[model samples]
Target chain A: MSKYLITIGLETHVQLKTNTKMFCGCSLKFGEEPNTNVCPVCLGYPGALPVMNREAVKLTVMSGLMLGCEISRLSTFDRKNYFYPDMSKDYQISQQARPLCLGGGVTIQTPAGPKRVRINHIHLEEDAAKINHYARFSGVDFNRCGTPLMEIVSEPDLSSPDEALAYVQALKQILVYAGVSDCNLEEGNLRCDVNISVRPEGQEQLGTRAEIKNMNTFKGIYAALEYEIARQLATVARGGVIVQETRRWEPDLGETQSMRSKENAHDYRYFPEPDLVPVALASEQIAAWKALLPELPSARRERMVAEYGIPEYDAGVLADAKENADFFEAAVRLCSPGLGKTVSNWFMTEVMRQLSVTGKTISECPLTPAALAELVELVDKRVINGPTAKELSAELFENGGMPGVLVAKRGLGQVSDSGALEGFVEQAIAANAKSVEDYRAGKKAAAGFLVGQVMKLSKGKADPQRVGILVAEKLARLA
Target chain B: MSHTLDVAYVAELARLELSPDEKRTFQLQLETIVNYVEKIGELDLAGIEPTLHGQALVNVFREDVVVPSLDRECVLANAPERNGFEFKLPKIVEDA
Candidate 1:
């Protein structure tokens, strides 16, 4: 029912795109042989010390600046004691008392309007090893161990599944634009944990919250929230109390099962890590990192709408991805004056379809911006008709070539010459005498069939609008 | 104020299987250590900055450079169990 309100928050972990591990000099590449990237520091061997990677710290600060967070001048790492096979030391080095960034938010556009979800903190930590399970035994890949990871914890400001999805999307766009992380959910680069609770309408106090973890895709996050919200609402409707617990989202089952209760929660004895020293950033360093922040996604979207005169919705769609927005701008720069909307339409429809089919991003598209601009120019100048341009676009999408060269090679130039069009129109009329009789007998729509025949005869090289006019003239003379 | 330490809980968190006598001895020893360290609270000095570590160093970071990683065989040599260049463990029933 609409009377009950759903609340959601997210804890997203992104693996920073760095050259080496956080505390060691091991390569941070993916899909390498198991344990190939392991080192003494990352493997947590006794007497081995850790030296913090400067690039990881710089990236964290840059990300904080982009998100409008307050970069803490003094931050330190702490040891979170736990027993897990993923970590060789049985303890994780994390930011417990103080994190790198604090108090930022992301703005998401919902159907109702735009809403801002507040973020609690973003802390820098190291990732654990990946575990692969089999029927009888398990294997551990230490390649991912000690990879620089940033955890972004947001305030419970989301209300619906759509809002949660928009929040994540917005965050990913900003991160990618700022060059912080790739935000790739497939290779486990980005992971999210959804915290959800529901309360009756007009309630000030919150209900018990359950956290759903290990969601690797945005679609799974949306579905998990939807299912959990309904389950919670039904429990409340049936006079049952919600329990505080951690749930595992079984994507195959489309349901969540309780993984751990409140009693089993680990009381991680957090203390300052002695091996690593404190990080004290100067004011000049903070200001320098802030200066490197680029124009974020939302601002770029608004500017695209205002400067290019495209519709707000179109700008929003284009600016949702960094590469898509960059491609649009590059193409628009080469377009003629007042053709921004034309370029946007081509990108949204034809270009997007091609991208989906080829499984390539806009950056990887074979057709360069100049090529697309030339095609649009050809259509505008009537050098090629609409159908010819459409056909050439598919050809260009498959094999990279100049549109003009392709048109010249294929003889797809539109025949707008009066003599050539008149000859085709006469042939069409002579072949379709019955349609001509139908038109003279007041079946006015029969002329459309004649026009179609003329196009077929011309092999779609004739200008369609000119064919219509020529057909009309020939038909009147016959009558 | 006095603090208490739950040795069983601590041992469980550390993934250690301790005997009952060892647990009792650890509880007493941890309490004594805490009591000994609590003596610093008796000082009345104010405006003292809390030291993060014993050393007075800050901003010790290495440059972003690529270095050689350990050999795969050498890295896996320290594992208690191995299976085809990977660390093998008992079947982990938990799903990711």
Candidate 2:
């Protein structure tokens, strides 16, 4: 492995976000009863015609646009022949000679930083039904049949697991943000097949690559690559050339095992699907739709960082989740971008924490962006201290309505009156003689405990930074 | 192009069980398919927009949901084994 360069390629199958199965009117819900959400076209009953699903196509084109692919003015579906129990039609309707989208790239952030992976093409196809195995006999569920699938294939540009992972993550992120697919791997909405081969450190020619299939998770992809690297290294040490074959990623074993010799497309006898006509997208139509795509997450992240002056890290965290980005934008427009960062901190740390505990999405939170904006405004204007504001934000997330109303209802308004704060500070000092002594002795950090005592005495309504400064000045006089 | 893709080789890679007679039949059929594909080669497609889907179709939809489903029963419904829903088959090893 040290002397050889591992070359990797990926084939990602993303299920489109559509209401019905690809060629049928059956609901695309994962469960309804085995074979329940299926009809003639999906079941491959004789003479049944497949009316092209426009939503699937639109989603595909949008995905293509997001990936920077050139849409093919003329694209068509073909029939891939096979005989599997799960294949109700004994063939898969797919694109072979021509596909919907071609030549795109994804830039991913790796330990080595951002690297772009070149995509060869993206094609549309139908998923096969599940082959249910039994001890006595085997049955099939056609519910998954004709489920819309878009296969995104990358060029042999990825050189390592890190690059491959970054590529997959970036591509998956784009697809998700495009609202093209949910990309839930366990549900098999997004599955990946990896092709790996090793070339001697300076060799110009490529090595024969093996295909690893059935990897259903990002973790599975990482483990599969690690195993392939080790396995290939051992083969090289033994002076044995690695064979090109298809392998199954045994996620539990964290290794890849040989499945079958990898085959090329000729094996499936790909031919233009005779039952369906070639789909020609009008230039004007695609042009109009292309103009409708929203600014992608990456661009939005950059905008938040550049225009809003929010920290890049915070912006990235907010933009990473679509809903969070929406909330951040809505809240940021109401207050200063600096306030967005602070509010983002509360949202990420406290709001998300509570959401995790209560199992709620940001959309499900009772705290509206307008209310969050209001709370942030109060804090930015020094109407409340950070702690009190955080408390109010949490209450707002748990409860409902405007922050100002709720703050009053909870009696948690911050106390900034210098005289009252001075009295509280005096009481706290009298009670904490040791801490006061420590503060006078130049133990600067001891002020925190004293400040905490004062805030506790004030019901946490005192502005913390203000209290800190007041306590430090008082301790200096005592010194 | 030095990278000649032999039809038979690709078929083997694809795990096809084509018979000898079928290979000859496919040889002709496949050649025709490739020839028709050459039409794409004819156009000076430089900067021409590609259509992802035909414009005539629309509104393909599925309800947003996760309906409760079978775990092993659906998997083993027609399986040819009883070893707790696993499909039992004749053991074949390729070490020979």
Candidate 3:
């Protein structure tokens, strides 16, 4: 609808959840005391040689396999030259020419259908230290230095802000499901850099782009894109040309500001890192890693829908988090074979609601899957009414207990016997003569009041459905 | 023989502030070293793959395990300035 076409590309950096740093033996921990994880290798001392971590390499290769990337047989590290206090090292050891993975794409669901966003490459690198800015000076914490990070560079395949959000969400889901990274945005486990440009409609040549750096949240990325896109469009509308430079997203200000101009752009003269040797991966090792990969998030969603006969929406909600999907599967396995939809219904309504109200994740849920299965089975067998079951649901979610045992201990089972229902109906009819006369006078709605009275007399354990049928039969016989 | 070295540009990249006299002196010295290194171009190395290191080593890695790091006080002993537990530097104007 506009006079220009916009293109967006993202460079996402995910910190791998490894036990140790990438090039050193320092433990990789978050929120630890600053500088406690410092070592000679990570501190970039004069004569410290960096040794690569095997687990870091394996995790990177596993991620590539999950994303359908081409595993590079021979990958090498290069030194990206820069001068910054955050990196203590004058250069960062990263992959420039030969990276670990190449040419894979993530399929993001769009309004039209599924769209694939092409990936340029995924390279392994080390994270820099944390810097806290003060009024007069800056403080640096080297605890985060040398932590393994993967930079996933995407091609300019996304055209809108919504597509970008979906792309990032999809990628994060896959990474989390693969167990490569925690993908916690709040903890700075995953960060994003967005490069966006705008060109006139029907223009073949791409316009100059502005790069927004170091966005840590999805909402922040989407907001930055909307602002930057409009800013470029306004610049072009007034016959101004777009300049290629780096910018920073000011989430508080809701705009992107120029961080540096193009004249001061970094010229990272990268060359082979002599400290670390090139990684030559055998074909068999790549195959072995591929075999070890678990079922990724996308595949699990489809399988859950097909195997469980649940709606696609339910499958998506359950698969949004790995722990949620795992809990759903565990509960379904404990229940009857064909009651997946029933279990999913409870999850969609009572289980999720209880979780939200209690502020707990599926992993932190106190109720066991076995208990949930038993509760569902009780309801299916007419052992408990809906109201009584719902009341017990709250109790079970708060403090877990066996549903069958709790039913017996509290006498909460529904009374569905024909004789017992007839007795309760007889008492209600004898007590409510006015209601019976009104029912005979063509006031059919009064039967509901009589059913309520029967429920109260039975102390809320009587099955309301069967009582309704019994009450109608008695009223008809009297008429 | 067709190689051209831009001394100023290379110095800028290395963040070195070189004097004109030093630049002129180093230019010849670097050219001499490069010319000597270029002698290998004459050899028939068509079948050989490019090598990045002197030793024939690849996939040399250590197991991922935590080893005790240096104590914080020892780590910060060499800091020019420290604020409590962190290394402090002059206020930076540019974002890293």
Candidate 4:
């Protein structure tokens, strides 16, 4: 068997979060009644003209700046002629010859180290209307038509499935941080198509590539690439030729089937759109959009590691989403500098667990950063033990309330008083006589049993460390 | 002028249902038009800038603001076929 190097490229379409349609004044909202937002301009009625939306162009420039792409000073929209029912117009107005952004790359952190995936260009276009097919007839919803969409094309710089996943994740983080798009895969706000090929080891020429389309999730993208690469490698190993085609990923079946061959490709006769004039951006305006880009994910991740002394892995997780990273920073700032790692651990473990269960984002979390800091402080001050703090965190996660007030109202405060814990310790020894005998009979591990008994008697409100010492003291009296 | 026009291919791209006679007629017409347009290459306009459009207007853009869309009945009135509030088409076996 011969080892082959896998090559992958990704083309992602992200719908920009704009108030209006790309070329019209229809509201760019999702889940509206079908065709309710349609107008003459977006519906492509005869004699209707399209005026460019300024904000959409500004957002494309912002995306270009964030991705380190060269902003094209003069860009224009071209009509891509195709026969699709999705677009009411036979032609889609898109940027082809001159796109809004050119030549950028996103650096992803692979296990081997940092790898930069080059982006060929980013173009702006209007999204096609959604088609919902039923048993016999298909319905066309024009609500999504004419929404500003940014299509980002990346070079074939990825070598493995993991790198491809990391590349999409990194790009998504930048898009979110720049506030260019919502980038929600489930909402069809973001869609990815991957082009993959494999060649024999040390081969200079690339193999024939297959493009996997309509992958809406990162996991699906990873799985489709893995399955396709294996299929290609096996075909080549057996002397079978790999055909250049497009495949649709059936996620449930965990395999890709041929969708269309290269010969059936559409010839989109592109011409400059005459309805809209060329956009000429000033240098000052470009500089202003560049300055408007927020601190990107990579910079935030590096700073989190340097400033908070968190592990690189933890920083990556914390800074993956801008909202979660902002929440961590806000909570850390409310606490002492030494508690950075402690605060990060709470977010990574408890907060993330709750979020996964509820399907809510960190921004939608009920617990505020200040309240989380207060809960951590209560644990530090011995007002509550570790177990009690976790319980309060669950409570806080459910209901938005102050951690201190919840502890006080529920009487969950830790009982560190020696008198109170000593009584519980004596009661535990009396109750677990067999365990006491085991302790005296050279079973040193029996002390842990007695301490657990004391915790049970105190209903977990007793400080665990103090209970351990008190249990030992009471046991020593028997000796 | 040496290039031949494939009118059938163009008709297919434009989704036009043309007969064989129409395709042949269009082929001849497109070739004539292409030959005529190719004459512009003979001009000695080395320093002249190519005009993108006839109008001198540039940078015409509308502010990003929401305007009222047409009512559902009015918008759907022009559709050749409609089902309830949606435009009804034949079952599309293909996905974009």
Query: Best lDDT goes to which candidate?
Result: 3
Question: Which ten-residue region of model 2 chain B has the weakest summed lDDT?
Answer: B87-96
Better of 1 and 4 by DockQ: 1
Better of 2 and 3 by DockQ: 3
Pairs with backbone N, CA or C atoms under 3 Å apart (clashes), candidate 3: none
* Docking level of model 3: medium
Candidate 4, TM-score vs. the true structure? 0.88
Instruction: Specify the CAPRI tier of model 4.
Output: medium
Q: Give the runs in model 4 whose Cα sits over 4 Å from its true position.
A: A1-5, A198-203, A230-244, A250-265, A419-441, A453-459, A471-479, B1-12, B15-50
Candidate 2 per-residue C-alpha lDDT over A1-479 given as tens digits, one digit per residue, 9 for 90 to 100? 35888899999999999887777677787756665576667768789887777788888999999999999987878888875656757789999988999998988776777777888999999998876654545556678888899999999888888788888888877887888999988789999988899888889998888888878889889889989988988888888988878788877877788864323433676766766777678899799879868778889899888877778888888888788888878877887656666777767787778888998878888888888888888878777778777777777888868877867777777888899999999999999999988877788888999999989999888988889989988998898
Interface RMSD of 3: 1.7
Q: Could you give candidate 3's per-residue lDDT for residues A258-361 as a string of tens digits? A: 98543434778898999888898999999988888878887888999999999999998898888888888888988878899998998879999998898898
lDDT of 2 at A218: 90
Every model's TM-score: 0.90, 0.81, 0.96, 0.88
**Model 2 per-residue lDDT tens digits across residues B1-96:** 122336676666566788888888887787777777777867888998654445544233334333332344544555565343333443422210
Tell me the lDDT of candidate 2.
0.79
For each candidate, report its DockQ versus the true two-chain complex: 0.63, 0.09, 0.73, 0.62
Worst 10 residues of 3 chain A by lDDT: A260-269
Runs in model 2 deviating more than 4 A are A110-113, A260-266, A336-338, A355-360, A429-450, A466-479, B1-96
Please give, for residues B22-82, the per-residue lDDT of candidate 3 as tens digits: 9998898998888888898989889998887767789989999999999999999999999
